[model samples]
Target: MTMQNPVRPLLTPLLAALVLAGCATAPPSLDKALPQTPAAFSEGGVPWTTAAPAEAQARGEWWKAFGDAQLDALVERAERGSTSIQVAAARLAQARAVLGATDANRALQVGLGAGASREAQRGLGVAPNTVLSAGAQLSYELDLFGRLAKASDAAALDVRSREALLRSTRLLVQAQIAQSYFALRALDAEQTLVHGTVEAYRDTLRLTERRYAAGDVAELDLVRVRSEVAATESEALALERQRAQLEHAIALLAGEPASGFRIAADDWRATPPQVPAGVPSTVLARRPDVSAAQSALLAAQARVGVAQAAWFPNLALTASGGFASSELSELFRSSARAWGIGALLSLPLLDGGRREAGVANARAELDAALAGYREQVLVAFKDVEDELAALRLLARQGDAQGQAVDAAARATTLSETRYRNGLVSQLELLDARRSELRNRREALQVRSAQYQSTVRLIRALGGGWGEAA
Candidate 1:
């Protein structure tokens, strides 16, 4: 009694080490884990304007920038009906439920029970006795090593990742709706142009037939004009087929039956809006996919901490209050009352390397998450750059195509006049008309590309430019 026990000295240091380990269980800082970001984007030439921080803001009706009411309605319909968005929302709900379950482990557990048991006596002449018991029990585990906290943190991060995925899904649906609508409108414009060309060709064919009947033109001229008329009509039919397909696509995107849906041909005047590319870091912060990957990485890191905690001893305190009696009717008597209190500390002395394997697996998962996050960031940067390059090149192409169309139209007019005066062959007039049709169709295609690219840029930037709007 006079001398202190030698085990007491060791216990103090052991407890100190355990406390230090618990304190170190927090996940690493995100700044150190994340890859370095560039200060500015590489592509230049278009005016780069600074936009307000959108990381915490909602994307807000970005499709409205196109100034099409029908488009806005379609996007709203898609948002409400898209199966992809519904799936993502369901996943988010599941993650939240898991977080709640993980948190429940930290709260005191309570239970009630009643039982009756009969046991035979070992001695001779002894009869079986029945004992009745009823009780309430409560238990709670002490978070001595931060295991529960780490697990909760991981679950919370999982919820965050699912939330980001839902946002990403919604954005994708909206962008698809915009692109399909713009494409349908482009086809409408092309179809109108082609139908008008067919009418002009028919008129030319009629004039040629009259000339041949009066012997003013050769039979070869009449045949050539007829062929042109047929070819122009065929082109118009092709455009009609294309527009029908586009309408069907838009209907599918809007979650409607293709057979019953239609977009009437109207004037195409929706101009692509100018989108500003903010700083590279800001873009990364705004992208929901990138945010999801980052959250996954953090969750993996927290799981590592949880796995390491398995090596520590677990402590639990339990209490029970109950009634016990040899006679069921007397179970509630004061003399038959029973109560218990317990404190248990358990540590696995030998596990055949199971804990080590778990730690290794957790670390491997953490590495995978880190790599995935890095890949997501790289892809985000690439998307923005690709769309920016496309918009720049498409704008220049549109300008050159416009000039070509003007020149082709003037040539067609002159060729028509010359052929009427018998100064040019019908073949020259046909060539001029073909060139004009080709240039006009190409110009419309370029405009359609501009519209699609603009929508993609908005998606790439994670939304519209909040302040630049």
Candidate 2:
């Protein structure tokens, strides 16, 4: 007797053609370095530059840049306590696990199974028997078209990108915590200033009231002094509220309940950290966000190779072995062993443009990633330039404002002397007092702005806390 098969002959030539076609397409070479002349450098602004003392602080502990023990402790606590950082770390671990899974696919998969059964004899005289079977199977892809390699590469890149994302989250958390801490300190300073001003006004008001009672000054003068006292008291109250809000913000960043955490009221004498000069090219690597973007680009590039690889055939090797025995004791015996091996060829000969669309989409994604990477570099440059300009302009403004404050102080002293000699009215003396107060407040604001600008510069230069004077 002869048997005939229809499907076997039909499948042979198609599989052969797929294998032949796959061999024709070459594997792509992935360049680790980005293309020269990144899109970031094309647009002109302030040439990105860093300026700092030649002897710079270590980068490993950039937070020490501010040289504040309290700040250093706060940052370290925030890093450990932050829920957002934990989430990012978990995501990175998940990505690495996924990479491991993909890598496992590139190697052979082996499995073992076992089964046992007992049966009674039928009326037809079949014998009662216990049956036992054990089996082993193995399967693996040959990766003849580099498809597995590309997929594993893409997964690895994704893992790296997620790791970079975690780093970016850490950097963001550090900066936010520091800024909030500084803001809280600034508010504390402002409150102290307001309270002192209130005390001075209270003293002045008491003197005016006494003088008015003695018929030495008008009642209107006492009322004016009382009003200044009220205004300063109001500002002090507002500052207390503002400081509370800053405290709450800091607590949230530190992953603690606002009620559970409190910052001690230290005098706001801690100076902004000194910024270090980093190389322009180094900025691209130092900024966590930019590094994340670059990692994403690398991942996307790897995906392109994966998508392209799909256009080729998949080659696989399959093998299976099993043992069977009618008697339980015979299972896994030498006579029961068996094994076989075969190769498989698979190809997507025709789809409704699906494979082509995949390739196109992957290419588009690569383009987008490259563009985003370039954009990040450009933004990094702009941030540095903006801080540089701000530092320069603020220093000049601070100098001029200091001069104005000094002149107002002198004018206040002269006016006080004039009033004592009856050369000026009480109103003129009040006017001079008010002018000096306004000048002093403005000067304080200028100083705060200059300090904050320096802080911005330090962050832009990537850590190195400034020393306190």
Candidate 3:
């Protein structure tokens, strides 16, 4: 008669459960947790033309749309040289290595050992004897509960999260460089305008002095013109100071020493890239931050599975084969050969609520990750909406500003002509000139804002490198 193992009945149910756990499921689809989004954005974006073939493939270097070669070179250099990018890359590499190590965990593990020992048995009246031994051991954790597998899956998701975060960091660095570069250019134009105004004021001052000397105008006119020239020159100096600061900021972003870096005065003419008529669904996928959050949530789910796995029994098999002998040379001899194999089954009878606490902690972490992911999605939608509204409103403001500048220019021309014909007072002519300068400067500011907003919107939509339309 065949005899059955006494524990067979008790183990049957656990073995069945372990088999069921092998079919572990991953986290649910992100769609179920995502907040509601509108089909169309509230603000219509800037009128952007369709991209050319070359432009469509430019990727993260969206600054190239501005057609500035210097900016392209700067962004490229930053991508390679910035410490921020380097740090993020290092983290991504570390996550990959961790995942690789975790994957390797789901395999047989072996260890080898050799040892020699001598023992003296004075009480037993035996002579001292020496023994030598050599052995190789093998052990494998039978992942019947899918515990190790779930841990590995969690690690893999972590790698994906890090990868997305790295991409997000790279996009942020590029956007910062573009915005700074554009701002510097705007300041350059402003300085040029200031310099011209200063020179024109100085020339007027000299003419007024001569006219006063010849009794063609009063001393008050010369004093007033001199004051205007002084103030204009002072404004030019301040503008140059601001330009230097912006240049320094750009150099730092490019990972260069500010003292050794300089961006010469250049024109700003970057046309905004086209916002493709894609809906919110695509944007969610393209945004790296959102992707990163989703990966984190998935990782959390995997961890919860790992924790739940602890409730199941653990199974391990271990084996060792070796030889032993009084003489080191005979350690591998057949006469001294020995081998052993064993299996272990562990079940938690009591753990003072540790396992339950672990499950609770894991569940809490999953909840937190889910909440965090939802927050990021909401923030992403808001970011896109905010930028669209800004661009739309800025476009309207720019149009009005342009009209104001044109009117001021016409008013200045008429006032100058009337002053030359002795039909307008010097105060009236000076006020008209200042108004034109102020209006022109304001218009340039509005244009700069438009370029900045365009860059912001591109970043909000996720850099051109991703699935962004």
Candidate 4:
């Protein structure tokens, strides 16, 4: 005990050194929270907007921005049924419960226990003795070294980080549902175009066969028309396959059997919902992933205090009060009462530099967390920038494709009229029909691309996952 006395005396000074070193390092303040300046695109004429959402806070239902009733229902279903979201929610709840438990009991700990025993001694005055005893134990750890405070702070930060992770998971699920829903609708548009093309090809084949029978066109023109019809039929089958696959994906997202679920075929239009791009600073707080990253940093920061607190001595007070008697009838009597109190001061002895190593590890972890946070912010900025660029470029392409479709439709009408009047060959009529079909298909693709791009933009903005359930 005397040899250990010297070791105990040096503990206070070491603890003081640790506390000073650990708490002194503050988290670096980030002024430029979000990235605003976008990378320049190769296409020189596209105007990229920097406007993000005006609301820095997240809303609950982000799918409503698409103005699609079906999409809104699907997102709701996904939120309710998604296993990943449920897991994340459960984790958040666990973290909150842990924080509550740590906070509520930090000041006091109490326990009650009872015991009964029988003892026999031949040499004693009484041949047999029986004792029954009950005791209440109370122990409280004084936060003299701020260890409990730091532990509570770390636990609270863990709750915040867990909540942020839940939000991030929700946002991801919403984005996937939106993207899949739009892609399924796009397939519908492609199927419609394919059917329309098949009809036009059939009509052209009929006209070509009639002219060939009347000696106005060769047999090869009739064969070419029939071949185009067959090809368009094949395109319709391929589109249907893609549509079914998308349907299955959506069903899986909603946590339902794909066999019984279906989305009705709907018209595809290029008018996607207009989302305002807010300032870059808003993205840091609004985006769930970014929020999660920052919360993780906060958690790491709190842990540094926890590590530093290990240097200080822990002060514990314990007391026990109980009633005891050898006779059952006298167990609760005043003469049978017994009480005691104790104070424990646990000072660390030499541990081969383990405490110092702990502080070093905590500092390293904090540095890594800070770096990871910065990386996430950079990735989020790039995501928004990429989506913004895609939207602008696709909008222009859709416009140009619309014009081409109109020109091809007019040209097809003129070619057919000329063929009927014997002013052009069957080849010219077939060419015009093919051109119209190609332009129409391109137009549908462009419209679909635009809608998909809008969905991407909403996802990058965190999809309003911050609402309370």
Alpha carbon lDDT at 225, candidate 2: 84
lDDT of 2 by residue, 1-469 (tens): 8787888886775677567555644335434433343433222232333333221223466656567888889989898899899999999999999999999998889999888898986797887787788888899989876778878888887777787677667767887887787777777777777787777678778777878899988888888888888887888899898888888888888898999889998876676654443233345535666667777887787787677777677778989999989877777699988778999877776789997798789889887887888777667666767776776677788788888878887987898788667787777777777777777777767667766666565555454333311
Against the hidden true structure, what lDDT does model 1 obtain? Answer: 0.85
Which parts of model 4 have CA positions greater than 4 angstroms off? 1-60, 121-126, 214-216, 277-281, 464-469
Each prediction's TM-score versus the true structure: 0.90, 0.85, 0.90, 0.86
lDDT of 2: 0.73
Query: lDDT of each model, Cα atoms only?
Result: 0.85, 0.73, 0.82, 0.78
Clash count for candidate 3 is 0
Estimate the Cα RMSD of every predicted model relative to the unseen true structure: 3.3, 5.3, 4.3, 4.5
Which portions of model 1 miss their true places by more than 4 Å?
Answer: 1-35, 45-54, 276-281, 467-469
Q: Write the per-residue lDDT of candidate 3 for residues 1-469, one digit (tens) a residue.
A: 9999999988876876667566556556767777776655666643223222221122455677778888899999898888899999999999999998998878898999988899998889999999999999999999976799999999999998898888888889999999998888888889888888888788778778878989999988999998998898898888889989988888888889999998878766667665656533355656788888888999999998998888788889999999889997787779999999999988775799998899899989998999999999889878878877887788899999999999998998898889878898889989988998999899989889888888887888677634344
Residue 253: error of model 3 in Å?
Answer: 1.4
Index of the highest-lDDT prediction: 1
Query: Which pairs clash in model 2?
Result: 65-464, 65-465, 65-466, 66-465, 66-466, 273-466, 274-466
Superposed by TM-score, candidate 4 places the C-alpha of residue 288 at a distance from the truth, in angstroms, of 1.6
Residue clash pairs of candidate 3: none
Q: How many residue pairs clash in each candidate?
A: 0, 7, 0, 6
Cα error of candidate 4 at position 187, Å: 1.6
